[model samples]
Target: MRRREVLGSLSGAGALFGLPAASAQGKAPPLPDAALAERDPERYWARVRDEQFLLPGWRAFLNTGSLGVAPR
Candidate 1:
């Protein structure tokens, strides 16, 4: 199966196992403003990383195995 499909299925399984889905964590931040991206690409990407993903800020995750890290 494709990577995205695998991750999606895993996320569903997480829900079945009583983990919170992304939406349940909180409301997602608004889409980064296009003008901000145009004006400051680095800042825009930082915003994307900080707001759009659930990765923790305290650690680096660098798994390169077949499954890699789960989506969130």
Candidate 2:
């Protein structure tokens, strides 16, 4: 993605920072593509990380860590 497009997409991220916990939970809103891509709290990281960097399942995780994490 181009830098401008990326910057525009992330333009509202700071809004969350200003919101109180209740307000943040009050409404569910649509997500931009970037946010959608990372909604996977399931540790959907690459199947391989830095070590082998090419192994089939080197970076996969069961993602049982974050209780509040979202689904892919």
Winner by TM-score: 1
lDDT of 1 at 50: 73
Model 1, 1-72: lDDT tens digits are 999999999999888876556458866668799999999999997787677766666656577466553343
Question: Could you tell me which residue pairs clash in candidate 1?
Answer: none
The residue-by-residue lDDT of candidate 2 on 11-52, one tens digit each, is 766566656875756554333344434776333333213222
Q: lDDT score of model 1?
A: 0.75
Q: Please report how far candidate 2 places residue 60 from its true position, in Å.
A: 65
TM-score for candidate 2, please give it: 0.22
Clashing pairs in 2: none
The candidate maximizing lDDT is 1
| Whole-model lDDT, model 2 | 0.46
